[model samples]
Target: MRLCPAPGGPAPLVVINHGSPARAADRPGLRPAACDSEAVQWFAARGFAVALPLRRGYGASGGDWAEGFGRCPQADFARAGRESARDILAAIEAARRLPAVSGDRPVVVVGQSAGGWGSLALASLNPPGIAAIVNMAGGRGGWAEGAPNTNCRPDLLASAAGEYGRSARVPTLWLYTANDSFFAPAIAQALHAAYTAGGGVAEYRALPGFGEDGHRLFFGRGGSAIWGAELGPWLAARLGRPLASGAAR
Candidate 1:
């Protein structure tokens, strides 16, 4: 994946990952996944330089996907621990070097869907110099069904979220789409449960833009506006003022 840095006090960095591994020029003709488009600009307006990575398999980043996960124990865990961490850490390092970012200020990691998982995993490590985190359409453990979905035990992701929420590590923003067919509402509730239980500070919000499609949020037409409205305030609170966890969607 590519890491695009903004120009200078390790300006607060926001990590954006593409959920699917599809290259920008794939047959799909390059649609935005994860958080891109207006969202990036909005964050940039807040003086935060965003770091977007294309992910390994789908993008130019070279890596062995088959050998890395291959039906092993917590294969997801192993890959996330090894590869995903490296990818995010690399982005963090590069973003910090930008002219806009201050060395003293940590980066803010934001992601959705698959990227959301990585963000949570990265957050668990609590790498040095991280300011805060935002998990949208993300989870703490695995899928409730545990089959068709790639990462079943996603609930485990909350360990890091739980820790962060309960302590002085970083402030967190949690956004969930009510009809998220991707992640059954139950699991979403579990995500909140784990974080709040962990004693962490998470600003939770809901959005209706996804409509009936469920997981295709990033691709949906209204997706951008929905997140922008909800995320905008959360970001404001993090970067400047306190915003609302509102909008019934």
Candidate 2:
């Protein structure tokens, strides 16, 4: 886990989650985001103490791989998402216990790729203290067989999203790109339609493509500028004020 504490004594918490690697073998080598990374600094500058948890079964925190969604044709996306959510929820609780993190302010959950899918699952639980979720290119079953835009089972993925939306009342921000190689615009729109149709509260935004693949927009260099413009106002409305200006060192 990597923690970047805000300058203030106690501040709102933001737990950022990493995505699942396309290759199964890469899971063991995954690592948490650096504390001083641009993404973490962005939150820290905004008065949020950031915690990046390396979920179980990934990287140095290896255990049993609990997020497998079974074989492709009939992947159990819901189960896999739930398992991922469990870890994120735990991370939130643990982070809140830190002295630098205030319990009064609501928590913000941010995730990319599979991590974003987990954030959606976490919303269904409506865990207290979680005020909002920011899903950046979130989805599973993407790039099947290493092919761009290929999905393992998009139908099942959409179904799982709807299932989560049935009880997810927390407001969410869904950010995607026009040229995502993993989950294309069409797939992203379908997932959003299913989620909102099932009663999930979400605001969706599709931005212009970035770099080779828009899927990496959340963590890619210079990526923050594009997403931050949209995210800043959205977060201010919920937090009741604007984020602190200037970057945190």
Candidate 3:
């Protein structure tokens, strides 16, 4: 885990989860091997000690892909999400052991794409010190057969979401763009509905389309500008008063 502490004493934490690539080693060449440094910097500027955990079986942390859901035709999305959640929880425990971090401080988990789905699954566990979750274009089993926004079994996805929502107590922010190629607006709404219907506390916001694939919102240079306005108040409410003057932080 790469722990980047902000410019403050024992700042709160933001566990940033990264999305998965098709191949274990293929990190898209553009994105880093671990969490996006740009995102870590953004959270750090806001007085958050960020912990970016490279989950098992991805990148340098090699093993059998623990989060694999099986073949597309009969994927087990629920099992896959739970498998990914285990690594995230382990990362949180690892972060809690750091001397530079306060174990009791509020923790906000922010993830993109597959990472986002993992975050939702983590919500069900309600790990201690976690205040909120921010799911940016979060979903699983997207791009089935290389077709954008076409999941293998969307009902199963919703069912898994409902299962997560049934036991989740953490508040989550669901942010998706109108043109997300990975998860279209309709699918995003269905996921949100399933979550909320199952007693999860979530706030959904569908933003305007970004350049080309909106799935890159959390990875782009100016992505925070679109999410910062809403995130600031949410952070304040969950982590106490906002110490950062800049909204972009």
Give the top-scoring candidate (lDDT). 2
Give me the runs in candidate 3 sitting further than 4 Å from their true place: 23-36, 246-249
**lDDT score for residue 44 of model 3:** 71
| Strongest candidate by TM-score | 2
What's the TM-score of each model vs. the native?
A: 0.69, 0.98, 0.92
Residue-level lDDT tens digits of model 1 in 49-160? 6677655544455554321333333444434533555676787787677675665675678777656656665665678876677777764223333442344455554444
lDDT-wise, the better of 1 and 3 is 3
TM-score of 1: 0.69
Steric clash count of candidate 2: 0
Show the lowest summed lDDT stretch of 10 residues, model 2: 240-249
- Candidate 2 per-residue lDDT, tens place, 1-249, comes to 777888958889999998999999999999888877888888888889899998889999867989899999999999998999999999998888889899778999999999999999999999988888999999899989888889999999999999999999999999999999989999999999999999999999989999999999998899999999999999889777878976687
lDDT against the true structure, per candidate, is 0.57, 0.91, 0.81
lDDT of 3 by residue, 66-118 (tens): 88888876778878888889999988888877876777877889988889999
Question: Which is the winner by TM-score between candidate 1 and candidate 2?
Answer: 2
Candidates ranked by lDDT, best first?
Answer: 2, 3, 1
Candidate 2: global Cα-lDDT? 0.91
